[model samples]
Target: MDILLFLIIIFIASILQTSTGFGFSILATPFLLLLFEPMEAIQINLLLSLVISAVLIKKLLKDVDTGILKRFVMGSVIGLPIGMMTFLFIDLNLLKLGISVIILVLTLLLVMRFRMKQYKKRDFVVGGLSGSLTTSIGMPGPPILLYFSGTDTKKEILRSTTLAYYLFIYSISLVVQLIFAGTSKTVWVSSGIALPLVLIGLYVGQKLFVRINQTTFRIFTYIILLFTGLYLLLESL
Candidate 1:
C-alpha cells in the first residue's frame, strides 16, 4: 500500500514540479513520511530531484542566465550550509509548520495580485530561504523562484536560472547529508525506485505546460497551496 501510494505521489509531484518549477517535494514529503523516516525521505527526494533536474539541464541550458544563476547559487551556497547545521537542533515538524504558514500567507498574497516586480533581489533572498527550508524541511525551492520573478521573465529566464541555482544547492546539501546526516541505505535504494516516477511526472508536466491557460494555472496553484498549507498546519499538532 505504501508503495502504491508513493507511485501516485511521484507522478503528482513531478507534474506540479514540471508545471510550476516547484511543489514536487512539498507535495511529496508528507506522503513520503508515512513510509520513510524524515531524514531518509529528504535524502531520497534530494537525490531524485538532482537526477531529474540534471536530465532537464541541457534543455534549459540556453535559457539559463548565468549572471542571475550566479547570485542565486551564491546565496544558496551560504544558506544551505547554515540550514544543514541548524537541522541538527530543530524539530522538523515545527519547521514544516512554519514553512507551511509562510507559504500559505504568501499564496494568499499571490492571490491578491502582488506584482513580482515589486520584489527586487527577491529571487536571491528566496533562494537563500528556500535552501534553508529545503535542508530543514524538504520543501522545493523553485516556488520561491516563482514568487520572485514576474510572468514576463518566468518562462524565458527565471525558471531555468532557478533550476541552475537549485541544482547546486541540492547537490551541496546532498554531500553534506552523506557526510553528516547518517541516513540509512534504504534511503539511497529508494531514490532509485523514485527516479522513474519523477521522469514520468516531468514528461507529463512538460506536455501540459503549453496547454494550461493563465487563469487555470493561477486557480490550480491557489487550490494546491491552500491544501498544502492546511495539511501542514493540521499535521503540526
Candidate 2:
C-alpha cells in the first residue's frame, strides 16, 4: 500500500510539475511528509524537482527571460541562508499554517483578477520569497507562480523562466538542506525510484502544454494554487 501511494504521488506530481513547471514541490512535499520524516520528505522533493527542471530546461531555453532570471538568482543567494535558518530553528507546523493562509489569500486575490505591474525590484523580491520557501518547506513555486499570474505573464515565458530559476533554487536548497538538516538514505532511494515516473510525466506534460490555451492555462494555475493552499491548511491543522 505504501509503495502504491508513493508511486501515485510521484506520478501525479511529476505530471503537474512537467506541465506547469512549478508543481512538484508544491504538491509532493506535503504528502511526502506523511510517509517520511520532514527532512526526508523535503530532501526528496528538492532532488526530484531539480531533476525535472534539469531535464526540461534545455528545450525551453528560447523562452527564458535572461534579465529576470539573473535577478531571481541574485536575490535567492540572500534568501537561501535565511530559509536554512528557519528550517533549523522554527516549528514547521506553524510555518505551514502561516504559509497556507498566505497562499489562500493571495490565490483568492489572483482569482479576482488582481494584477500587478512587473518591475525589476519585484523580481528580486519574488525570488527571495521563493528561495526562502524552498529551503523551509521544499516548496518554491507559490511566490513565483502568484507573481507571474498577477503580472499576466505569457504561459510560455512563465513556464520556461520559472523552470530555469528552479534549476538554480532547487540545487542550492538541496545542498543547504543536506548541510543543515541532514539526510537519510530513504530520501535518495525514494527519489531514485520515482525517476521513471518523472520521465513519463515529462513526455506527457510537454504534449499537454502545446494543447492548452492561455485561458485554460490560467484556470489550471488557479486550481493548483487553491488546492495547494487548502491542502496545506488542513495538514497543518
| Top candidate, metric TM-score | 2
C-alpha positional error of residue 54 in candidate 2 after TM-score superposition, expressed in Å? 0.8
Cα lDDT tens digits, model 2, 32-68, are: 9899888899998999899999999999999999999
Query: What RMSD, rounded to one decimal, does every model reach?
Result: 2.4, 1.0
**Which parts of model 1 are misplaced by more than 4 Å?**
116-120, 142-146, 149-153, 156-158
